[model samples]
Target chain A: MELRINGLKKYYRTGKEKEVKAVDGVSLEIGKGELVSVNGPSGCGKTTLLLISGGLMNPDHGEVFLGEKNLYRISPDVRDRERVTKVGFVFQQFYLVPYINILENVLIPTIGLNSYSASVEQRARDLIDHFNLSDRIDHKPGELSTGERQRVALARALINRPSVLFADEPTGNLDDYNAEVVLKYISEFAADGGAVLLVTHDKRISRQAHRSVRMKDGRFVGDDTNPVK
Target chain B: MSLINKPGKRISIWMIIKNELVYKKFGFITGVLSLVIATSGFVGAMILLRGDTLATEQLFMEKERELRAEMLQLEDDYRIIMRNMGYNVLILNETQSISELEKEGYASTYLDYEDVWKIAESGMTTLNHLLPVLQEKIYWPEKGMEILLSGIRGQVPVYSKPAHLTDDDQYRSPIMERVPEGKADLGSEVAVPLNLRPGDIFTIRGEEFEVNRVYSRRGTRDDLSVWIPLDKAQSILNRPGKINGILALECVCSTEELGQVAREVKEVLPHAQVFEFSSLIAARADVRQRAAKLHEEILQAEMAHQMELRREKERLASVLIILLITGASVWIFVLILNNVRERKHEIGILRAIGFSRLKVLQIFLGKSALMGVVAGIIGCMTGALAGVLWSGTGLSFSGQGSLVTPPVIITGLILAPLLALTAGLLPSVLAANQDPADIIGER
Candidate 1:
């Protein structure tokens, strides 16, 4: 398994006696070359599950394993290092730094990894070319269209060649055409032996995944294999 | 559009700060402006203080020089008054009786006329202006009167005395004029009784003489006397190359006592005794000391006034500097805090992509430091220039370069950045500690 979660539970205090079960006793496993999608409506805890699994948020009771290394068992600094080197995250907002160009934006992950070399830069350029963003590499995020920004975000995610990719609503802000393009890139990442855990409410996106999991009230209701279209 | 422009360069924290500053022009510029105002105020105050000290020192020297000139003039006036009063010391034969000298108004005992030369050549510093005089009361048969006749010549110069430029004989003599070989100067009482004038012929005990000038009336013993050539009087009195007294003026010094003058004179003239008119010497010394005391009081008063003014200026500048620094610190704090608030999502995204908390802190802190560095340079130049102009020192770099010394400039340079860093610390820490999950929400 490229990424695994065992008995994960997270809660939020709503009042003195009331709490919301954001993720409760959830368990899932993803192998290399497999793209799994969590389908849920708004406020259904799918995003929370993704956040806990990506080593960004701590679960109250659970273990998150990236290639047999428990993220929660290690120190925060080590966990951060593990996440930067082995896990990549993509969000719906495409939170790009407005002042820097798209090429620098894609190379930002390499800065965290402290691994920028001629080869790393060459790979970034290749990723830009693959995402069809070579023409827009030098343009700031404000100047780029919605589709171009999402593509830039996707390229940034794949730049470090992480073992697992966690994307939350990566296509929520894009048009149908751009969403299809972004989803295609994500599928390609998994095809190249990467593990992908995508969380979204769009059922149509779930059909494109190798397996789909339906979540409600912080629990998985059904897990099924989706037919390849 | 230019892919080749950014290929070999790494994206550093400083580079990020630079780009961010360019993007947020208003915030960075306003921050820099506030820092410049504070730093310039500090630099200006320092320069102004230095200039004031220099000006005060120069003014003090000028005033002291003027006072010295005035003191010298006062001393010359006192010398003239004392000279008119007569010599303060009388060196006579050691065997002369004090009672006989007082009763006859002349020394009964006599000393060699060459004895006066011995004192002058002794290089003694205590006395100057030696005049050898011979006097006696005699009945004149031709004039049909009794008179005290005195013989005198030009004063003897003492080589050891420092030359008083005012006492130069080329300008004017400091004592009575010498009587010529065939002339005489009669006292007012004698001249009135004898009906003599400047060119009148007179006879003194069978010796004929022409009256040179009639002396003005003095209420002292000199009014009843007649001055004539020393050789003529010596011949008439049958006292050749002999003198009853040596009249000399004692040099007045603050440390010189009346007894000291007598002792110094007797050391050179062992055969002669010194008689210093104590009242006359005391009065001259008192006048000089009083003048010196007045000069000292005036100089001290001027210095105290200047110091008071400097203290007032220092107080005002200090208050102004404190206010400026406070205002700048508050402004920087607010600007950086607002910047952190506005860039929340950017920080979140950077953290989510694996940037550490320290890197985020470097981004904000680096921006603040850049602002301070640039402002420090501008503030130093403009502050020094403004200080010079405002103080009316004139903009001459050669005269005023030391006012803006290296230490002052270095402090200004270091102060601005340190202030910026100190003021921006809290906001930068807050930005660094921001949780990526809370900012970039899972939803």
Candidate 2:
């Protein structure tokens, strides 16, 4: 699937008198196997752009399309349905439910919505194993290392096998070694024909992207195609 | 964070509840306990608030007042009946007027008292469910001695009293005020000397009468004295209701109450001789005073008890209300709300991964409903058990004798879950309304 944005504009009220354009007429597209990165300083609206593209927020104007389907034109709930089956989010903070074990955390989205059989469990086990955290699969997030926690978050994000992966500053809290492992995994995901839209302030991350969009104050400043890629 | 790998999951309500129990044991247990307490309170209140079942003291006062009113009516009716029969009458204040009455040749006497015995014709039934042993106790007082009781015990010679006094006096001392309707005083006394007591019953010529008391043991003409009810004796002796002798009291107005009784008696016997026994009238007044005081005490006691019961009932009701409203519902709302706030980021991730708002609502509401259901069931069982265990006094549930009935059960079960579901409402909606974008962006 392709995540396509056209003139997407989302405004925010910073104060009673001030309205800030968080995503001001921004547009972009990330096709399957595309590893696109949005880079900016603080307040540049990269996160806002990522959110609107992922169907997590509504744009004041313009539209977001997943392939031929205009997500913003669809009903909010329908868009949510589209998101549940089609998109995944990896946050910098690794937002895992604290009480649930890693395996159950991975299963949280399926709760009361889907049935988990041996294959489902096996898929989750494979993800944990691929992340080199099989021994910690049943452990809670509190008991895991920072890298392990982020990996669990990654595995959880991919548990639905979303066609589009949204990673917002995913490696912002990770060390260089852990960040390298995360980048390699995200690169591998794009190699496997899954689209990845990564938002980061880190130049190292932007350099690794096959394509990069640089933003200043919610508008695109430049687009770069990495020479190596 | 996803429902991707397989066909849509069919998660049952039970599975959700099981997960809730596993995840939130303390909240679930507390919710249930509060519901149980509330339900039990309701069960108890139902019985306590029922009509037709008065507290024992209240019942006693009611019955005593009824019996007194009946006795007064019966006495008035009997005197009127006697006067209409063209019988000469003499009214006396004191019953012990043998000296004055004998001097006037109007003293009624009996010798060798003969007991008139009659068998029950057939099918004489009593309303008492505890009456199967009545016959054994009725005819042969010794066989059912424990149940043998005396309504009236008037001696024929030494202490003869008209027998109509028995019914109202059944539960009182036999010396209370009596009836004036009777047959002529028999000159011959047919005595039955046996080990029989005054309360004993005997039969003669298919007639039945309870022994009043052993007549004089002295070897005198009074030794044969025996007494029976005036109407029964008249019926047995083949005489109409008539009194051959009169005992009269010329009452002087010492109190307004005596003036009333004197006025009533004078209304029946216009020309009857009257004599005053001031001491006996005073004694009767004293007795009436004591009785009135006792009745007042009983009323006050019952009123006080009722107030206490009312207060207690209100307390239980208030507690139940609290448990239903603020206790179970509010506490659950707060707990689940805290969970939502604490899990804001987690909720955001779930939402981003495709969990719908409705799904989010379902999780929290489902947990609350489970809590309610469990609390309801446990409360119902324990409340019913409390009813059964305390049914000895009916104070546990429904102060009345009603058990934990069907309405109570239905209310307990339905109300608990409903209330719990209600408690979960805002929290669930708030949790479902969480904005994934805001939460994720904040992270």
Candidate 3:
């Protein structure tokens, strides 16, 4: 499904009768098999855009269309269903469940769902194996290195087979090698027909994307495609 | 290809809770111990209070029972006395008026007591005490000790054999209806100083009475004394039913009742004296009154002692309750507050990575609940053991284990977890509802 956004806006109250527009009238589109990167400085609404698109925060005014359905037009419960089954997110800090093995951390999206069976277990094992963590499947997050934890978090984000993936500074805490490895997975996920949106201050991350958008002061400043880094 | 199961999620939640509890040993121990100690105090106080209450109640009941039995025994004794005295014995004292008798709990009884007569002196005979026949002599000293015998009359019947009768002598003839009519059914072996037969007569004080029947010898006082017909004694002694004094078997009654009777008798017979025939009855009543008064004082002391115990229990309970709430609440509140503060970034990451706010709340609540379970078990056991150890049993040293009963333990088990949950609530909710963008900065 192609993800479409139109006229997105959000605001915050700094004091009585005083307000700041965090995200104001922003718009973008990403097709299946397309990975889009949004780059901006601090308070430039890059994170706010991603949050609204991922249904993590409600926008004051916006229409987000995932395929033929308008995400914001639906009930919050239905939005949650969409958020869980159709969207996956990655954060800069690997939010690994501190007590659990890597495989169990990857299975968090299935919470509150009664649809558990043998195949789900095997699928978790397979995903952990795919991440080159088969030997460390039972190792708690505390015992893992930074790179391993990021790998576990990536595996967790993709465990539910979301149609769109949102990443907010996914490699912000990583060294160059680990960062490249994380970007490569995002690129590979786009190549596998899942739409991708990556918000970051790091220009290096946005430089190599199929499309790049630049934002400033709650508005998009530049939109470029097919450009050489 | 990837899939996840619900149980897999539950296991994940369980691991998160277990992880913090095991890794952060100091926090877990501090939290648990706070709850345990407070719970133990509450449970222990309640156990002791309950035990004391039961023991005091039991003692009070026993004392009451003993008092009731004593009162009933007095009542039974009074009933028996009434039974023995024929329930209707009468006495006459001519000196008193009817209005005076009415002042007691009885009316003035107009009935008169029949007399048993005595003679002052007689010549020509020494009466044999063993002689069963009553003797009355009617003669004048100027007439040379001669007796004029009255003709035979109808016999008056009585049931009590004279106490003076010897074991071998039984009354074969009907005795007089009046009390202590000195005559008896004399035993045959009795000796008489006078020559007398069943038809013989005797006189005294210028009046005469006949010996209706001569009886067998009675080796007792009956053999030595003489008895005369009641009417003959009245005329010869110059006294009738208005005799100066008479002995009676009274209605066996309570001291209060007997006092009332004596007052009534005094009202009717102002110069007459009435009292317990045996000295022991009055003395026993006095003893009982003193004993009852002493028992009452003892009971009042016990009541005061019981009141003190109750006040102490209330005081201890209030203190324990405050201690319990403060300790448990402070422990959970500070522990969770610190934990949530430390884990803000983790919470942000979870929200960004697809875990819900509810899931975050569950993780922390589960940690506190685990603490509650341990506190419950430890608190209950310690409290129960303390209760048992404190109370001593029958001889005042070891109890029948009236210490921590079921309610105390139940309250501990139920209340411990609840306190922990309440303590953890605000911090946990704050942590759970934390925004991912705020702490982890756009995660």
Candidate 4:
């Protein structure tokens, strides 16, 4: 699916005395099946831009469009429904529901998709196997290594086969080998006709995407088509 | 699976119950305790109320029996007095007339003095002659005379004597031969002598009687005299062909036929006073006014006391039940609330996983409801067993009566759990209304 973010802006009020413009007048678009990365220093509005694109946070101004439906024009409940069906979100912390098993965690999005679907379980099993986590399906997040936990979170995001996946620092907590594994998974998801928008501070992870943009002070400062250089 | 065919709500309820089983022991215990207290209170109240009702009924019945016995004894006393006085008693006042006596070939009797003196001087043979003539006109059976005579004998003194002449050439009396020398003498006034005291020898002249025993005539100037048998009086007075005036005593009648007998006796002896046995007893005992007033007072007092006790008991039971229910509810609510508070992280996860606020509420409430129902049932069963074991065995605090088992205790047990659930509703709803986004954000 084509994703468009137009003139997005966000601000945070600090104790009623100061205002911080996290994302200011920034816009970008991604074609179907394309993987794009937003790279910046910490507190440079990269995460804010990703959050707005994934519908996890509302922008103070501007609009987000997935194909023909404008996300901001609809009620929050409707937007949430659309987001659950069409968008997948991965956070920097993995944010895995701690008490549930890995398989159950991966199956969370499918539960929202339909109350009862036999195929959803099979889909979850296949995702676990794809991520090489079949042996740890019943293990809780606390028992899993950081890399395995991130993999489980990715499986959870992809359970509904969301048209667009948004990842914010998908490998920020992992070692080089685990980060490569996570990056490979994101590239494979993009190759399988799913569009991806990733935000990261790591140049190596950013280079894996088809295109890259650099943001500074809530505005895009650079656009590079050849991200590998 | 088809969404509608799946038991989504039921499954949620099961999950709620399962969660409660895992996390809410204190809430479960409090609910059970509430059921126990409610059931026990209900059973105790039932026993007390039933016992009081039964005792009051018994008291009324016992009082009724005593009143009946006393009334029967009073009637017997009046009957004996009539017999002792040698009179035929009648109940109706207008049955006989002086003209009827004259037409029946007897001397007309009057309430005036002349006829009274003549009859007193009359002999027994003459009285016997009058009896036959009276019988022909009276058309009454001998049983009527027996009844009449029995009533007269009931009124007379137990002992009597004949009047005779003394050697002093003055009148001689069995009771007192002559008046005291300095005192005003009542020469020939008639008197009745009694040998018994109150509550003594109850029979006179072959019939039962009750003697008042004290004989002080109010405003009377008369001779002290003795009561003599009719035959002995006739012989001593030397008046064999005449009779003294007939005295009539009164008695009660349970049937109309007896009253008719009294009326017939009046028709035969016009000067005789006819009295109904019921009216005579009423008058003699002064029972109509006094008994009615006393009964009214007693009934009012009893009813008022019963009502007051019932109200007090209701107030006490209500307060106790309310306090028990409220205390149980508050404790259970607090426990459940604490449980919810501890499960805040779980709640955040569930919300993140797309569980609605309302569903979260349902799960928590469902747990409490299940506990309430189970505990209530247990309480009811225990209460019923206690009632059965203690029924009719006089396990009670009030000295008036014994306790009875009540069905309401079982009903209370059944309702206690529901009440507990209802009590938990507010807290559960509040917990459910908590924003999932905010909870997760806090974390």
Candidate with best DockQ:
1
- Cα-based TM-score, every candidate: 0.92, 0.62, 0.71, 0.61
Q: Candidate 2 has what TM-score?
A: 0.62
Chain B TM-score in each of the candidates: 0.89, 0.46, 0.58, 0.54
Q: List where candidate 4 sits over 4 angstroms from the true fold.
A: A39-51, A92-103, A138-147, A168-180, A200-204, A212-217, A222-229, B1-273, B276-280, B283-310, B324-353, B356-443
Give the top-scoring candidate (lDDT): 1
RMSD of 3: 10.2
Rank the models by DockQ, top first. Answer: 1, 2, 3, 4
lDDT of 1 by residue, A50-100 (tens): 888988888999999999899999998888889989988889999999988
- Candidate 3 lDDT over residue span A1-229, tens digit each: 4789999999988899898888899888898989999989978888888888987677899889877778889986567667777888887777776855677777766663433356666777777787778888878888987877888888888887788999888888999998888888888888899899999899998766888888898899998785552
Q: Candidate 2: which docking quality band? A: acceptable
B1-443 per-residue lDDT for model 1 (tens digits) = 33334557786676689889999999999999999999999999998988888778778888989989988888788777777777888989999988889999999888888898888888888787788999988888887888888998878767675473145531145476788888988889899877888898977777889989888898777878889878887898899999899998777745457788677777877888988888877877887888888889989999999999999999999999999999999999999999999999999988888889988898889988998999899888888888777753643456476677889899999988988998999999999999888887634
Backbone clashes in model 1, listed as residue pairs: none
How many steric overlaps does candidate 2 have?
34
- Output the TM-score of candidate 3: 0.71
Candidate 2 — which residues are off by over 4 angstroms? Answer: A112-117, B1-37, B44-324, B381-402
Report the C-alpha lDDT of model 4 over B164-270, residue by residue, as the tens digit: 23444232312222212111111122213323344443332333333333334533322232223333323333434334233433333332334554454444445
- DockQ, model 1, C-alpha based: 0.64
* Ten-residue stretch with the least lDDT total in model 2 chain B: B127-136
| Model 2 lDDT per residue over A139-219, tens place | 878999898889988888787778889999989999999999988899989999999999999989988898999999889
iRMS (Å) per candidate: 1.8, 5.4, 5.0, 6.4
Report the C-alpha lDDT of model 2 over B1-443, residue by residue, as the tens digit.
32232355433434444654676677667767766666666655554443223454456566678757855665455334432322122343234265855553333322111210000111111100000000001232323222111111231211122232244433122221232233111102233334556555665335565554454455533343334454454444443433332322222222344444334434443433233345555554455556666766766777778778777766776666665556666777777787678667767877787778877787778877777777778877776766555543623234434455678778888877887778789988998898988888774
